[model samples]
Target: MCRTSILPSTVKAVKRGEAGSAGELRGDFDLSGDLGPLYANTGSGIFGRLEEAPRAGAAVPVGMALPGPATILANVRGDEVREYDIEILKVAPSSADGRDLVLSVTDPELLEETGGIVQGMSGSPILQNGKLVGAVTHVLLNNPEKGYGILIDHMLEAAGDGVD
Candidate 1:
Protein backbone atom coordinates (compact mmCIF):
# COMPACT_ATOMS: atom_id res chain seq x y z
CA MET A 1 0.00 0.00 0.00
CA CYS A 2 2.42 2.61 -1.20
CA ARG A 3 1.27 6.21 -1.63
CA THR A 4 2.82 9.65 -2.16
CA SER A 5 1.94 13.30 -2.04
CA ILE A 6 3.44 16.80 -2.08
CA LEU A 7 3.97 16.50 -5.84
CA PRO A 8 3.83 19.27 -8.38
CA SER A 9 1.00 19.30 -10.88
CA THR A 10 3.34 18.40 -13.70
CA VAL A 11 4.60 15.37 -11.85
CA LYS A 12 1.12 14.15 -10.97
CA ALA A 13 -0.39 13.92 -14.41
CA VAL A 14 -1.30 10.56 -15.92
CA LYS A 15 1.13 10.83 -18.79
CA ARG A 16 0.61 7.15 -19.65
CA GLY A 17 -3.19 7.36 -19.84
CA GLU A 18 -3.50 3.82 -18.53
CA ALA A 19 -5.92 2.24 -16.09
CA GLY A 20 -5.28 2.46 -12.36
CA SER A 21 -2.80 5.20 -13.11
CA ALA A 22 -2.96 8.54 -11.39
CA GLY A 23 -0.64 11.46 -10.89
CA GLU A 24 0.57 10.47 -7.42
CA LEU A 25 -0.80 6.95 -7.28
CA ARG A 26 1.81 4.12 -7.48
CA GLY A 27 1.90 0.48 -6.38
CA ASP A 28 4.41 -1.35 -4.17
CA PHE A 29 3.67 -4.86 -2.97
CA ASP A 30 7.25 -5.94 -2.39
CA LEU A 31 7.09 -5.46 1.36
CA SER A 32 7.25 -8.53 3.54
CA GLY A 33 4.02 -10.55 3.62
CA ASP A 34 2.95 -9.00 0.34
CA LEU A 35 2.46 -11.42 -2.55
CA GLY A 36 1.76 -9.26 -5.57
CA PRO A 37 3.78 -6.99 -7.80
CA LEU A 38 3.29 -3.24 -7.17
CA TYR A 39 2.47 -0.42 -9.57
CA ALA A 40 4.97 2.30 -8.73
CA ASN A 41 6.46 5.44 -10.35
CA THR A 42 5.37 8.23 -8.06
CA GLY A 43 7.41 9.48 -5.09
CA SER A 44 6.57 6.75 -2.66
CA GLY A 45 7.87 3.30 -1.78
CA ILE A 46 8.61 -0.17 -3.33
CA PHE A 47 6.99 -1.97 -6.28
CA GLY A 48 3.41 -2.98 -6.92
CA ARG A 49 1.21 -4.77 -9.52
CA LEU A 50 0.41 -3.51 -13.00
CA GLU A 51 0.05 -4.73 -16.61
CA GLU A 52 2.50 -3.14 -19.03
CA ALA A 53 5.78 -3.57 -17.21
CA PRO A 54 8.63 -1.35 -18.25
CA ARG A 55 11.98 -2.82 -19.24
CA ALA A 56 13.96 -3.12 -16.04
CA GLY A 57 16.88 -0.82 -16.54
CA ALA A 58 19.82 0.22 -14.37
CA ALA A 59 18.25 1.61 -11.20
CA VAL A 60 19.33 1.54 -7.59
CA PRO A 61 17.91 -1.20 -5.41
CA VAL A 62 14.77 -0.67 -3.32
CA GLY A 63 14.68 0.49 0.33
CA MET A 64 17.77 2.67 0.05
CA ALA A 65 18.36 5.37 2.72
CA LEU A 66 18.65 9.12 2.13
CA PRO A 67 19.89 12.61 3.28
CA GLY A 68 23.33 12.02 1.82
CA PRO A 69 25.42 13.16 -1.09
CA ALA A 70 23.87 12.21 -4.41
CA THR A 71 23.93 12.69 -8.15
CA ILE A 72 21.06 13.11 -10.55
CA LEU A 73 20.91 12.26 -14.24
CA ALA A 74 18.75 14.74 -16.07
CA ASN A 75 18.28 15.56 -19.76
CA VAL A 76 18.40 19.28 -19.17
CA ARG A 77 20.09 20.25 -22.42
CA GLY A 78 18.83 18.38 -25.48
CA ASP A 79 19.08 14.60 -25.37
CA GLU A 80 22.20 14.42 -23.33
CA VAL A 81 21.82 12.96 -19.86
CA ARG A 82 23.91 15.37 -17.86
CA GLU A 83 24.99 14.77 -14.29
CA TYR A 84 24.50 17.21 -11.44
CA ASP A 85 25.68 17.04 -7.87
CA ILE A 86 23.07 17.35 -5.15
CA GLU A 87 22.46 16.84 -1.47
CA ILE A 88 19.48 15.11 0.08
CA LEU A 89 18.48 17.81 2.54
CA LYS A 90 15.92 15.63 4.24
CA VAL A 91 14.07 12.34 4.05
CA ALA A 92 10.35 12.39 4.74
CA PRO A 93 9.55 8.96 6.05
CA SER A 94 6.29 7.16 5.27
CA SER A 95 4.82 8.69 8.40
CA ALA A 96 5.21 12.02 6.67
CA ASP A 97 2.70 10.81 4.07
CA GLY A 98 5.26 10.22 1.32
CA ARG A 99 7.20 13.43 1.53
CA ASP A 100 10.15 11.38 0.26
CA LEU A 101 13.46 13.19 -0.22
CA VAL A 102 14.19 16.89 -0.28
CA LEU A 103 17.09 18.12 -2.40
CA SER A 104 19.44 21.02 -2.84
CA VAL A 105 21.10 21.39 -6.22
CA THR A 106 24.73 21.86 -5.41
CA ASP A 107 26.10 21.87 -8.93
CA PRO A 108 27.22 25.36 -9.75
CA GLU A 109 27.53 24.56 -13.46
CA LEU A 110 24.05 23.17 -13.68
CA LEU A 111 22.66 26.21 -11.87
CA GLU A 112 24.33 28.54 -14.32
CA GLU A 113 23.00 26.46 -17.21
CA THR A 114 19.41 25.67 -16.22
CA GLY A 115 18.90 28.23 -13.46
CA GLY A 116 17.71 25.41 -11.24
CA ILE A 117 15.34 22.44 -11.46
CA VAL A 118 12.98 22.64 -14.44
CA GLN A 119 9.48 21.40 -15.09
CA GLY A 120 10.51 18.65 -17.49
CA MET A 121 13.11 17.13 -15.20
CA SER A 122 10.51 15.53 -12.99
CA GLY A 123 11.60 12.02 -13.79
CA SER A 124 15.30 12.62 -13.53
CA PRO A 125 17.12 9.78 -11.79
CA ILE A 126 18.65 10.60 -8.40
CA LEU A 127 21.67 8.52 -7.46
CA GLN A 128 23.21 8.33 -4.02
CA ASN A 129 26.31 6.31 -3.26
CA GLY A 130 26.18 5.06 -6.86
CA LYS A 131 22.67 3.73 -6.38
CA LEU A 132 19.40 4.89 -7.95
CA VAL A 133 17.50 6.26 -4.99
CA GLY A 134 14.64 8.20 -6.55
CA ALA A 135 13.51 10.76 -9.17
CA VAL A 136 12.99 14.49 -9.20
CA THR A 137 9.31 15.05 -8.56
CA HIS A 138 8.91 18.71 -7.68
CA VAL A 139 10.64 22.06 -7.66
CA LEU A 140 10.48 24.91 -5.20
CA LEU A 141 9.60 27.75 -7.51
CA ASN A 142 10.46 30.32 -4.89
CA ASN A 143 13.87 28.72 -4.67
CA PRO A 144 14.73 26.85 -7.82
CA GLU A 145 17.94 25.75 -6.18
CA LYS A 146 15.86 23.41 -4.05
CA GLY A 147 13.38 20.63 -4.92
CA TYR A 148 12.05 17.22 -3.98
CA GLY A 149 12.78 13.61 -4.99
CA ILE A 150 10.85 10.37 -4.82
CA LEU A 151 12.40 7.16 -3.67
CA ILE A 152 13.54 4.70 -6.34
CA ASP A 153 11.77 2.01 -4.40
CA HIS A 154 8.45 3.60 -5.30
CA MET A 155 9.41 3.55 -8.95
CA LEU A 156 10.37 -0.11 -8.68
CA GLU A 157 7.12 -0.89 -6.95
CA ALA A 158 5.06 0.94 -9.57
CA ALA A 159 6.95 -0.69 -12.42
CA GLY A 160 6.84 -3.94 -10.52
CA ASP A 161 3.35 -4.57 -11.85
CA GLY A 162 5.02 -4.56 -15.26
CA VAL A 163 3.92 -1.11 -16.39
CA ASP A 164 6.12 1.77 -17.34
Candidate 2:
Protein backbone atom coordinates (compact mmCIF):
# COMPACT_ATOMS: atom_id res chain seq x y z
CA MET A 1 0.00 0.00 0.00
CA CYS A 2 1.13 3.57 -0.72
CA ARG A 3 0.26 6.77 1.16
CA THR A 4 0.56 10.26 -0.29
CA SER A 5 -0.68 13.83 0.10
CA ILE A 6 -2.19 16.19 -2.46
CA LEU A 7 -0.25 19.15 -3.76
CA PRO A 8 -2.05 22.47 -3.48
CA SER A 9 -1.32 23.57 -7.03
CA THR A 10 -2.46 20.23 -8.29
CA VAL A 11 -6.00 20.65 -7.05
CA LYS A 12 -8.51 21.60 -9.74
CA ALA A 13 -12.26 21.48 -9.98
CA VAL A 14 -14.69 20.59 -12.72
CA LYS A 15 -17.76 22.84 -12.75
CA ARG A 16 -20.60 20.80 -11.33
CA GLY A 17 -22.21 19.90 -14.64
CA GLU A 18 -19.36 20.38 -17.05
CA ALA A 19 -17.26 17.25 -16.72
CA GLY A 20 -16.85 15.45 -20.02
CA SER A 21 -16.84 11.74 -20.82
CA ALA A 22 -14.34 9.23 -19.36
CA GLY A 23 -12.03 9.32 -22.35
CA GLU A 24 -11.63 13.02 -21.81
CA LEU A 25 -10.65 12.44 -18.19
CA ARG A 26 -7.89 9.99 -19.16
CA GLY A 27 -6.41 12.54 -21.51
CA ASP A 28 -6.99 15.39 -19.08
CA PHE A 29 -3.30 15.73 -18.24
CA ASP A 30 -0.75 16.50 -20.92
CA LEU A 31 1.51 13.44 -20.48
CA SER A 32 3.33 13.77 -23.78
CA GLY A 33 6.55 15.05 -22.19
CA ASP A 34 6.25 12.45 -19.47
CA LEU A 35 5.11 9.37 -21.36
CA GLY A 36 6.80 10.12 -24.62
CA PRO A 37 4.75 10.38 -27.81
CA LEU A 38 1.33 8.80 -27.91
CA TYR A 39 0.41 7.62 -31.35
CA ALA A 40 -2.75 6.93 -33.30
CA ASN A 41 -2.72 4.93 -36.51
CA THR A 42 -5.48 4.13 -38.97
CA GLY A 43 -3.58 2.79 -41.98
CA SER A 44 -3.80 -0.88 -42.89
CA GLY A 45 -0.07 -1.56 -43.29
CA ILE A 46 1.67 -3.51 -40.46
CA PHE A 47 3.88 -0.74 -39.06
CA GLY A 48 1.32 1.94 -39.84
CA ARG A 49 -1.28 0.02 -37.83
CA LEU A 50 0.93 -0.55 -34.79
CA GLU A 51 -1.21 1.45 -32.48
CA GLU A 52 -3.61 -0.99 -30.91
CA ALA A 53 -7.18 0.03 -30.38
CA PRO A 54 -8.28 0.40 -26.78
CA ARG A 55 -9.98 -2.67 -25.43
CA ALA A 56 -13.74 -2.48 -25.83
CA GLY A 57 -14.63 -3.90 -22.39
CA ALA A 58 -11.37 -3.94 -20.50
CA ALA A 59 -11.03 -2.12 -17.17
CA VAL A 60 -7.83 -0.26 -16.36
CA PRO A 61 -6.03 -2.01 -13.50
CA VAL A 62 -5.41 -0.39 -10.13
CA GLY A 63 -2.26 -1.30 -8.14
CA MET A 64 -0.93 -1.84 -4.59
CA ALA A 65 -3.25 -2.72 -1.71
CA LEU A 66 -5.65 -0.53 0.20
CA PRO A 67 -3.87 1.96 2.45
CA GLY A 68 -4.75 2.81 6.02
CA PRO A 69 -6.11 6.16 7.26
CA ALA A 70 -5.82 8.77 4.54
CA THR A 71 -6.99 12.35 4.91
CA ILE A 72 -9.32 13.96 2.39
CA LEU A 73 -9.83 17.70 2.17
CA ALA A 74 -12.77 18.24 -0.12
CA ASN A 75 -15.47 20.80 -0.67
CA VAL A 76 -18.58 19.59 1.03
CA ARG A 77 -21.97 21.28 0.81
CA GLY A 78 -22.02 25.09 1.02
CA ASP A 79 -18.56 25.37 -0.55
CA GLU A 80 -16.92 24.39 2.71
CA VAL A 81 -13.81 22.24 2.45
CA ARG A 82 -14.07 19.37 4.87
CA GLU A 83 -11.51 16.85 5.96
CA TYR A 84 -12.18 13.18 6.44
CA ASP A 85 -10.28 10.01 7.17
CA ILE A 86 -10.07 7.31 4.53
CA GLU A 87 -8.84 3.76 4.17
CA ILE A 88 -7.80 2.24 0.91
CA LEU A 89 -10.01 -0.74 0.21
CA LYS A 90 -8.09 -1.91 -2.82
CA VAL A 91 -5.64 -0.85 -5.52
CA ALA A 92 -5.06 -1.75 -9.17
CA PRO A 93 -2.32 -0.89 -11.66
CA SER A 94 -2.72 1.37 -14.66
CA SER A 95 -3.79 -0.29 -17.90
CA ALA A 96 -0.91 0.91 -20.05
CA ASP A 97 1.31 -2.13 -19.19
CA GLY A 98 3.60 0.49 -17.74
CA ARG A 99 3.95 1.18 -14.01
CA ASP A 100 0.67 2.89 -13.30
CA LEU A 101 -0.77 3.49 -9.85
CA VAL A 102 -4.44 3.26 -8.95
CA LEU A 103 -6.31 2.76 -5.71
CA SER A 104 -9.67 2.61 -3.97
CA VAL A 105 -10.79 5.02 -1.28
CA THR A 106 -12.84 4.30 1.80
CA ASP A 107 -13.92 7.85 2.55
CA PRO A 108 -17.62 8.61 2.23
CA GLU A 109 -17.40 12.38 1.67
CA LEU A 110 -14.83 12.04 -1.09
CA LEU A 111 -16.78 9.20 -2.56
CA GLU A 112 -19.80 11.47 -2.82
CA GLU A 113 -18.03 14.51 -4.32
CA THR A 114 -16.00 12.54 -6.83
CA GLY A 115 -18.64 9.87 -7.25
CA GLY A 116 -15.55 7.69 -6.78
CA ILE A 117 -13.67 9.76 -9.39
CA VAL A 118 -14.25 13.15 -10.98
CA GLN A 119 -12.64 15.58 -13.36
CA GLY A 120 -10.50 18.50 -12.18
CA MET A 121 -8.96 16.07 -9.72
CA SER A 122 -7.01 14.11 -12.28
CA GLY A 123 -3.70 15.84 -11.77
CA SER A 124 -3.80 15.99 -8.00
CA PRO A 125 -0.24 14.99 -7.23
CA ILE A 126 -0.17 12.57 -4.33
CA LEU A 127 2.64 12.84 -1.79
CA GLN A 128 4.10 10.84 1.04
CA ASN A 129 6.54 12.51 3.44
CA GLY A 130 6.47 15.35 0.96
CA LYS A 131 7.49 13.10 -1.91
CA LEU A 132 5.21 12.74 -4.92
CA VAL A 133 3.78 9.25 -5.33
CA GLY A 134 1.10 9.45 -7.96
CA ALA A 135 -1.80 11.32 -9.54
CA VAL A 136 -5.49 10.54 -9.63
CA THR A 137 -6.74 8.79 -12.75
CA HIS A 138 -10.39 7.77 -13.02
CA VAL A 139 -13.23 6.42 -11.00
CA LEU A 140 -14.36 2.84 -11.16
CA LEU A 141 -17.70 2.68 -12.95
CA ASN A 142 -19.12 -0.05 -10.75
CA ASN A 143 -17.95 1.83 -7.67
CA PRO A 144 -18.07 5.43 -8.76
CA GLU A 145 -16.36 6.61 -5.60
CA LYS A 146 -13.31 4.42 -6.06
CA GLY A 147 -10.62 5.79 -8.39
CA TYR A 148 -7.23 5.09 -9.97
CA GLY A 149 -3.81 6.79 -9.81
CA ILE A 150 -0.62 6.78 -11.87
CA LEU A 151 2.54 5.93 -9.96
CA ILE A 152 4.86 8.91 -9.48
CA ASP A 153 7.99 6.99 -10.35
CA HIS A 154 6.43 5.96 -13.62
CA MET A 155 5.44 9.54 -14.26
CA LEU A 156 8.94 10.74 -13.38
CA GLU A 157 10.60 8.05 -15.43
CA ALA A 158 8.43 8.87 -18.37
CA ALA A 159 9.15 12.52 -17.85
CA GLY A 160 12.87 11.97 -17.25
CA ASP A 161 13.42 10.49 -20.69
CA GLY A 162 13.25 6.95 -19.30
CA VAL A 163 16.30 7.30 -17.05
CA ASP A 164 16.34 4.95 -14.06
lDDT of 1 by residue, 54-157 (tens): 34555345448577788888755433467899999998756243448889889988776655676666778888777777888777766777778777665555
Q: What is the lDDT of residue 3 in candidate 2?
A: 21
Candidate 2 backbone overlaps, count: 16
Give stretches of model 1 more than 4 Å off.
Answer: 1-63, 95-98
What TM-score would each prediction reach against the true structure? 0.61, 0.44
TM-score of 1: 0.61
Question: Native-vs-model 2 lDDT?
Answer: 0.41
The window of 10 residues in a row where model 2 has the poorest summed lDDT is 41-50
| Quality of model 1 by C-alpha lDDT | 0.61
> What TM-score does candidate 2 get on C-alpha atoms?
0.44
List the global CA lDDT of all models.
0.61, 0.41
Best by lDDT: 1
Q: Relative to the unseen true structure, what is the C-alpha lDDT of residue 70 in candidate 1, on a scale of 0 to 100?
A: 88
Error of 1 at 66 (Å): 1.9
